[model samples]
Target: MVVSLKESDFFSKNRRALAKWISAVEDRLPEGLEFLQRHYHRVGHAFRIGITGPPGGGKSTLINALLRVFRARYPEETIAVVAVDPSSHLSGGALLGDRIRMDAIGLDEGIFMRSMASRGSLGGVSEATADICDLLDIYGFDRIFIETVGIGQLELDIISLAHTNLLVLSPECGDEIQAIKSGIVELVDIFVVNKADRQGAGRMVNDLEYMLGLRVYSGEDWRPAVVSCVATGGSGEGADGVFELVEKVESHRSWLQARGRWGRKNRRNLERKLRQNLFHYLQREFDFLQPLLEQKAEEVEKKRLSFSEALEILLEEFSRQFSSSLKKRKGG
Candidate 1:
């Protein structure tokens, strides 16, 4: 059966429809792109929070705790979580399915949880992550949390999409300090030291404070807060810091709004999304030239053409074909 976007159920707060639309967008279907384009104006209402750090840093646990706190504090608001995990090499599915750790949140009707595979992307996120976030935003979620796969210095893509970014750290990870030194510290809005009950947690907090002190931040700028938490503990005993974390996130949101930076940030995010979509569209348009590209490769392998010569030929042919197609469309 063909599902039409014109159906009121598709645009309503229907979980099945939302899931179907996300899957279509992930697969890069034309109908999916059209649906998003039609509703582009409805985005930018939700507060996006990004959580990232090294593998086994207890990011999922921290999010689980945060979910409990948020649900308790704002029982009426809706929440959505997008957990990105490393992809399985053989099956191309999320390896860990972090949702398993968030089973408690899954039971809440106000909360929506999705697990996405990184698909071997070095940025710790999949290409369709931003699109999925957009869908969630338009679906009227009050808050959206995106947990990235294990990240490194260059995996800062989350900073562009999230209004506030939390860098999760663990006392058990010996490389925590080293990872911070790799430039990840500069990208985060909050530092969360999970597993505070373990040894070295205080030292990690001190190290982060010292690093922050080195940077000459303006007095008017928002200072990142470093909080400690034992996310795995029950009855909120280990999650004492979750409240402070929520407070800091709210403070940052207020700071951005008061300074008139929220609109600017949303515009910047939209620009990035536009650039990404244009690049992908160009790539799809170039698919027709693949056979010719292979032929050029064969010629180069046989020493009939140099690499540069083959590239020039391909570009010239592509330009000619593209121009002809434009003319045909105009005439028809």
Candidate 2:
């Protein structure tokens, strides 16, 4: 049986209820949209940070280190993490669940961690990621971290949802200039070089600094800072440069807030979210035109009609049906 949850349950910070609602949203169920609508007013309180990079870039370890720093700095504040993992083809579940990697952090009462499967999203994030972030914000978490699966050229969906986007890199991923060119470098607010203890770390930093120097940013004078860190806290050595990384992130946040860009960014994010939701709704309702669409496809296959011509016919039929439905409603 599908579990039902009330809005009050979410407002009260009930983990079980929150988890169920997130699942519903991930599955694109109507109840989830309803819940989001009910609690829409409570969002925008938490600061969202998106961490993304190539596989083996140590994003998970970096996040784990940052979590420790956040807890120590703000002991009383709540923190939430949404880790996106590749989906398992057989089970359709998160392949690398949060509990397996960040078990220690999950044990903390002040920290809430949930893993979501990318489920074939090319951008290294799930479609429901922004919605889940909103729910966490409404739950009163002071900070929200969205860690995406391994990133590539088109993996820039995080830019639309996060206030600050961190592009993680590693020394072993040699030729930093070539690496940045392959990803969406312009959208990043900060660059983090994890595994700083490895060789070529300094060279990587220099390459990134040189590339960033060529960009001409408008309005504000905030330049993306490159910070080095070994995230594992290995034998009292892994925590190196972590404090600097955290400081740079906080500094960017303050810079955005000072110039009134924070609110503007949030508005832009809302617009993108609304557009995505509308597209999803239209896709869900496509069944109303599916039979006609199939017929149109067959016509195209037989060369009886061009693809564009068939599409036009399909749209005309859809418009007629939509008009009839509206007329019937008015008469009723």
lDDT of 2 by residue, 225-318 (tens): 8998888863233478888888999999999899998999999988887887677656655668988898889999999999999999988887
Tell me each candidate's TM-score: 0.84, 0.86
Candidate 1 wrongly placed segments (more than 4 Å): 1-6, 151-154, 181-183, 235-238, 278-332
lDDT of 1 by residue, 205-266 (tens): 89878888887778677778898878877536445677788889898899989998899888
Task: Give the distance in Å from residue 116's predicted Cα in candidate 1 to where it truly belongs.
Answer: 1.5
RMSD versus native structure for model 2: 3.3
The TM-score, computed over Cα atoms with residue i paired to residue i, of candidate 2 is 0.86
